[model samples]
Target: MYLFLNGEILHKEEAKISPFDHGFLYGMGLFETMRTYSGHPFLLNDHLERLQLGLDTFNIDLDLQKLDISGMIASLSEKNGLQDSYIRLNISAGEGEIGLRTTPYNHPNILLLQKELPPLMPLREKEAVLLKLRRNTPETSVRLKSHHYFNNIAAKREAGDDPGKEGLFLTKEGYIAEGVTSNIFWISDGKLYTPSLETGVLNGITREYIMELAGTLGIPSEAGMYMPESLLKSDEAFFTNSVQEIIPIHTFEGRTFPGKRGRIAQQLYSHYERDAQVLFSKNELHRS
Candidate 1:
């Protein structure tokens, strides 16, 4: 495999990082996961926008506007010989002294990694279980897709290795937070509902886009602190992320849901498929 690190593409095994890098030393870094459809990056601008916000919050100095991100993705795609792919754009604070510093990190390491992906199918299903491990509070005011990921890793282990199952997490206070690696949502009475960001859930990009899609379909959406029992009253439920898009939950807490057969899940996913086909940046979609 090959990766784009700094300004050049190199074999993954050949790429190197300093042991003193703050990102390595102290987990001071951020990353964004994106997917390409027919070689076009869906929601490229929005992902970068979120990435920029994370960089600002981390005190990592990097100007994305000066970089040709699309061009980079295209180059990596050609080099890796994959069109449908998973992309992780990472930026980490460069070398720093042993102690923590309040000063901004001027030099940061940027990396782009990709992996082949089969064409995503709409309404793909997964089973969810309430995890015993509670969601951890974000280190900052809002959660950034940063190097601090042990919480998610632990949740994944607790959920076990069933690829078709996703572990749902509740906040320390027992309010529904989100899936281990995705945001959770459910539909009831023609309305869509999800755990609010106040619950310390990561404000996922796809989560935001799904809410937008709901509005376009005239579906009222609400976000608030919810409990596991709420799924019992739900007609259908699904999970969302940049890569998986919309994953209909087939079962939760021993209760069965409509899953892929759900009317609302079908409608939202159909619209999601149509938009992904056109492959416009989320910003462009909003402008029109």
Candidate 2:
């Protein structure tokens, strides 16, 4: 694998960051996981825009405009020999004094890594257990994909590595939140519903797209806090994330759903695949 560090391409062992970096020391950093379609990044601008917002919120002064992101990705893809790739883009507050005091003036360190995207397995219905660990209020008042991930880590630890199960989280107030790393959605009577962002959801890019897709297809959709009982009664349910898109849920603890890959889920995924090609054409993707 080849990783882009600042301005150079380096092997995994060659990449390095200061131990004192605020991101390393205090979890002051942002990361975006992206997927490349064919030979180019899918929804690159959307991801970057969200990243920019995080940079502004944290007062981290990293300007992405001065850097040629498309070129960097292409160079890395060529070097890594992985045209279809999974990307991890990181920006951390550079080395700073050790303390909790906010250090917004530190230079930002950038790291980009690329790897071959494996063939996606069939989208089977997943089983999820509602964990006792409740999600905390976002440290920044909104989720920003920051490095402060102990809550999620703890939940993941509790869930363990089960191929057939995932951890579902609840808000401190005991409302439906989301899956460990994916946004939760359910369909009832042909209507689509998801936990509102106000419920401490991550505002996933794929989740937003699916909402738009539902509107475009005339599927009734709503986003708001719902009780866990709502999901248990759902006719169909699924989770969404950038890489995997949509994964149907077969059973939530003991309550079982039809898990038949409902019409909404199927159409959204189909359109997502088609939109990727039309939205990211060869000319736009390989602009470098």
Candidate 3:
């Protein structure tokens, strides 16, 4: 695999970052995992916008105009022979002396890695277990994907090595926070239900799109803090992420969903796929 580091691409084995980087020393970094459709990145703008916001929050003034993100993604995909692919785009405060002083990063490290994926199929179904880990709201602001990942890592370690199962985290208040690495949703009598962002949950790009799709597809949706047990009120449940657009949840802590593919999920997924095709056609973005 080739990794786009800084402004150059290198084999993964040769990729390296300074050990003194603040992102490594103090967990001061940001990342976005995205996927491609016909060679164009899905929601690249949204991901970049979020990355910029995080960089801004820390007073980092790296001018993104100097970089061609779309070009890089497309070129990287072509170079790696990836029409259908998984991408991990990461940026961290570059080499900084030890300690957590509020100093600006003079040399931020930006990297992108691409891997081939089979043609995207419906994510099908998976099972989940409620974890004992309590997700507390950030003492600062709402969560964005960041380097402080120990809580999530710990939860996943406890979740064991079941590929078909995932762990769900509940807020310290006992409300459903999110999945280990994806945002979760459920359909209750055709109305979509998910946790509100006010809970300091990670602002997921796909999570936002699902709600937009619900409106486009005319499925009523609501986001707010509800008891974790409230998931039982739904007929079907699913998780959303960039790579796996949607995966049905057969059961949550033993509460089985209504069916393999619920009506609302089927509609939303169908519409999403159709819309993407139309988007590619209209934009004429497929790369060879």
Alpha-carbon TM-score of each model against the true structure = 0.97, 0.92, 0.92
Which numbered prediction scores highest in lDDT against the true structure?
1
Error at 38, model 3, angstroms: 2.2
Candidate 3 has which clashing residue pairs, if any? none
Q: How far does residue 151 in candidate 3 sit from its true spot (Å)?
A: 1.0
Expressed as tens digits, the lDDT of each residue in 1-288 for candidate 1 is: 999999899999999999999999999999999898888887888889889999999999899999999999999999999888999999999999999879999999999999998766657899998899999999988999999999999999999999799999999899999999999999889889999999999989889888887786689999998988887789999999999989999998889999899999899888777676555455444654
- Weakest 10 consecutive residues of candidate 3 by summed lDDT: 279-288
Task: Sort all candidates by lDDT, best to worst.
Answer: 1, 2, 3
Assess each prediction's global lDDT (C-alpha) against the native.
0.90, 0.81, 0.79
Q: lDDT at 252 for candidate 2?
A: 87
Q: Give the per-residue lDDT digits (tens) of candidate 2, residues 171-211.
A: 98888998888899999999999999898778887787778
lDDT of 3: 0.79
Worst lDDT run of 10 residues, candidate 2, spans 279-288
lDDT score at residue 65, model 2, on the 0-100 scale: 76
TM-score for predicted model 3 compared with the true structure: 0.92
